[model samples]
Target: MILDSSLNITLDNSNNAVFRILGEERFKITNAGPDIGGRLQFSNGRYIHASVQDDPDVDELRFKASGHLDEPLRIYGGSNYNKRVGIGRLSESPSRPNEDMSRFGLDLQDTGNGYLYGLRLTNDTTGTGGSNGACIYYENSNMYVRNFTGGPIKFKTKGAQAMVIASNGCIGIGGITNPMYTLQLGFVNSNSGGAQRHANWNYLNSSNNSFKQLNGNYGNISIFVGGHISINGVIVCVSDKRTKTNIYPMNPVKSLDNLRLLNPVHYYYKDFINNPSQLQAGFIAQETKHVLPTSLEMAGQSIPNILASASYYVDSFKNKIIQFSDFDTSKLELDNSGNFYPYLRVFDEENDIELPYWITISKILSSNSIQIETKEELPSRVFVYGQYVDNFHLLHYHRVFTTFVASMKEVDAELQKEKLKTLELQREMNELISLVQTIQK
Candidate 1:
């Protein structure tokens, strides 16, 4: 709202009212226009004007005509002019636009204080020639505006930079000043040397306040050291070594690369020429990357060399394990070597148990399709001797004696190797000691 001359204004039954002075209002709203129950009067030389807007139930501007209009009053916004001199309707206050984006509704201005408290100007048509076509300026200063019910301040940027509603002191919102905020979209903020939160993804051009959405290339919401921001959504946040932010862009892992790594070969039948120890049936190591047996030149073999013996291959183990349930009942295969292979799955479970033996498995075939299997106990539940993958029912038990014997064998092998090395070292030391003694004599 623009205030040029001095005037004594009295309004009745009005909603959001503001007293404009000089600088435009983009700070905040703390004014609800006088709730007049009688007629309104405007004194002094400056013309009495009002920009009345609002919904059907909301009285834009109303004045008791019976009251005397001893002064001239001009009503544009929701200003109630009973009978006054030089009474004229300047323009209607802008209102909430419809979905078609045809017209604009209201243009909020400062009422002396730095806030959008009351309606000062209204551009009805809101098209090319509407009064709301442009905007009012609100510099950063200590302006105070009050809201009756705290009607939300609105914004629409044709080519504006950023709309910063600022204030020196903490903003105050009366009941009416704060209206019903539904699933609508717009920018409402109060910049009191504090944070500036944009509504509907609004942004300001670093140069000026042309009030527009964040369209052109520029950074979005930012929080600084003295600044703290919080957003709740299906938000994607990222923090580098230094800065932390709620929004960033990352290239999603594409299936093209994963497809290249996937193999149609049976998961269990993977052949690893290198690290023959891990490839052995009972080998228990973690994280092995088996370059799924390709027809490529590797392990001293040409392209067509399917069998390369005496090759020192390195097969990195993986945490992947076979779950009996992963194999479709009809898909389970029994090879001619009397081995049944089931499909592997990606169930989350800790697998750290290791059995020393060859991890032998036994299956007993019953007459009525019942099957029981047993295995030498291993550290993890990776293989169920004879149980299906579901619910982890009972399989045959591991022989306690077999496990004990396996442990003993491992200990004996280590001891024998150490003993041989110790003997050889002792012999060498004795020879050195004899030579030292002869030299001394």
Candidate 2:
């Protein structure tokens, strides 16, 4: 039978109906039984258009054209309005897509508020209209995953919930259930008969910042504002011999002399102006680095000293001057010479002290003779301690323990020598008294 100019229908030998359009097979309907269900097949790139109303003008579903076989079949909703695709039970009111309908299955809805999309999953086993499930939606420039059942959203791995995002926006790891803080971690301890051992990083408020174990006897580690860290337990450092290399003994006398050069001071941090009376006792990093240069650790890469091999001498005005024949004067312009200030110090051989001074470059008097002025008079022999990398010096204060022990040993040797001198003087005085007694007799 011919229905229109492009449409044609005929029955095959097995009584299966075949439909064609423009001489091409567009669809085929099989004469299978109801139990087997009659098959309806559409050719490639063909689609079925659907409409809610019988009116020919309203097409709620439209087909998208696909040029390749691998491209997925796309269905578009009606134009100029948002639409919802619902599977299983739906709400009585089709217009209110966001209504709480205690239905089972999924609903993907577009609310038409700037292309916002919502996906809701509901499970109402009791048949009562109590919506309880999860919803993943996008609104107001943010995507939200919400669970209306007041339960946590769990991420599972290896048959166990590895992480959970609580209803109150708290996060838990290692199978934690009721997280009391913003972030919590836990573990199921087999030794404790599956007890939950956990640590909480509580930053709920500015005044209550702490990271501590909740169910165990472990102490807390708190970091307060103003760069202060309070640890309730002793700090231990790894000092295994296997981890160390190039071991050598320090010279006790030299170590003692170097340690003596470090001057301990009682001072407060510049930022801690509110507590002026609260003094901290420690050696200055710069002074300690001068005393035990080997103990200093660079924060990052060590900067090579360009003037390390340069000869240093004091000018007529007692200003220190560094002379390097191969120095690059082009890099150091006279206008910006003051910005490249170098830290200079003189080792007084006779006085046995290091006098530190800052060298301000006044002029690039040639590559070899860069005229520099010091704040104070420098000693005869000048030494360059290298320029600051980023206007700061980082020193490892903990590495000075070996030098401190060596200094103690040097002090003990001095005490031993004083004891020997006292013993010899006492014996000589005894002999002199005996000689005086013999002459009197």
Q: Which candidate is the best by TM-score?
A: 2
Local accuracy of candidate 2 as per-residue lDDT tens digits, 1-441? 445554545554544544433334334433321111111334444444333454433234333233532212222234322344333122222333334332222434354544233565575574331246666766777888767678888899988889899888888888777766678777555432333364344333456765433334343232213245566667666577887899888899998987878787888765352234477887777777778887665332112344333456776886557675455655542113446543333344445554554566666667556666766765544443334343244556666777788899999999999999999999999999999999999
Encode model 1's per-residue lDDT on 305-350: one tens digit a residue: 1111111111254222222423233333344464543322111124
Q: Tell how far residue 170 is off in model 2, in angstroms.
A: 18
Clashes of each: 73, 0
Query: TM-score, each model?
Result: 0.16, 0.37
Candidates in order have lDDT scores of: 0.31, 0.53
Q: Which stretches in model 1 have alpha-carbon errors above 4 Å?
A: 1-90, 93-104, 108-110, 118-441
Candidate 2 Cα lDDT to native: 0.53
Indicate the TM-score of model 1: 0.16
Which lDDT value does model 1 have at 79?
A: 23
Candidate 1 weakest lDDT stretch, 10 residues: 300-309
- Supply candidate 1's per-residue lDDT for 321: 22
